[model samples]
Target: MTLSTEGIEPISNAVPKVWHIETVLIMETCPMVLAGIRHLLAQPYFQIKHWLEVSMVVDIPHIIKRHEADLVIMELSGEGESILDGLKIINQYLANWPSASLIVCTALTDDRLLKQLVAMGFMAFISSRIRYRP
Candidate 1:
């Protein structure tokens, strides 16, 4: 005997699919900034996997490699050596994990710096002063 019925519907049509939760790694110096970031990503769609302070900038690449984070949020404040270090860290991270996204949240308003960051493959740049009412 041969089976000949062909009227089955797809399971995806029957049930709603939940958004995939993206794992995030944060590198920030300020406690208030870190707290704000935690609050912002408290939704079900984002899972924070690791937190790194500014002093641990050199270890960022290693942490990212180990965690395989989907996104990295880094604060790029201050001037002189700190800015240079931030740039170097970004370059190193991209060299190892080109697919992972990087976001720079800084108070800097220099257009040249923004352009340079974009050229270096940062996915987004958000101002630290941005307020969300929702």
Candidate 2:
């Protein structure tokens, strides 16, 4: 950025920017992983509001609506079939909250599934696979 001297003006009419602390929701089938996520997000920055077990609940959209989540992180590791199921469930609910971001973490990295997620307007896709050491 360059400063203009010829057209010098007072910087008094600027509007202040507002920062918002994000509310995050994490849902996973594994208890250990879910607990770990909660502990990690217990930081002073993030507003961790909702933690839902994917297996325990059938109506994911309802839960999401009740929470009105801003950020949703789902782990698709334990249940193989749940990857698609969770995606579909969240995708439908996303219509209600267009500003919400949905991210998925999984060990199985499938190109087709990733493409599908992108098509469905998913925010991010994270692969949790570890490389084999020879």
Candidate 3:
């Protein structure tokens, strides 16, 4: 069975109302990748805040308090452990932004992992890899 977006529900918290136009929090270890994504999003349309270190995500609750983003995107670029750690970090802050969306971007094409991510309240899992046909 395919998981539909309509079936996925947003994580709800009893936070105050803040009418924002999509505040984004990007968690990535690569500076270049972070810069590229930041450049893509318009400043007026989105409030983009980034967490640079995957290791530093242990202090995610405090970081979320400072950044306060509605959309949290994680780049799964490292090894299996890092990917697992990233998911853990994202889950911790899910309560920080109840209505926020969490999305994972990776080159991995594992169907089992994709199913797990969806079940974990990850609204989207985007493949970052690009293939060119000759």
Which of the two candidates, 1 or 3, achieves a greater TM-score against the reference? 1
Candidate 1, backbone clash total: 0
Prediction 2 TM-score vs. true: 0.63
Q: How well is each residue in 1-101 modelled by candidate 3, as lDDT tens digits?
A: 97676855556434423325435666655566666666766445444444333424444456677766667667654433456666676667565555677
| Candidate 3 segments exceeding 4 Å error | 1-22, 30-32, 43-59, 77-81, 130-134
Give all candidate RMSDs, comma-separated.
8.6, 6.4, 9.2
lDDT (C-alpha, whole model) for all candidates: 0.73, 0.63, 0.61
* Runs in model 2 lying further than 4 Å from the true structure: 1-23, 49-57, 76-81, 130-134
The prediction achieving the highest lDDT against the true structure is 1
- Decoy 1 TM-score against native: 0.69
The most accurate candidate by TM-score is 1
Measured with C-alpha atoms, the lDDT of residue 59 in candidate 2 is: 51
Query: Residue by residue across 58-102, what tens digits does model 1's lDDT show?
Result: 656677666677777887633234777789989888888887788
RMSD of 1: 8.6
Instruction: Summarize candidate 2's per-residue lDDT along 107-126 as a digit string, tens digits.
Output: 66678877777787878876
What order do you get sorting by lDDT, best first?
Answer: 1, 2, 3
C-alpha-based local distance difference test score of model 3: 0.61
Supply candidate 3's per-residue lDDT for 100: 74
TM-score of each: 0.69, 0.63, 0.59
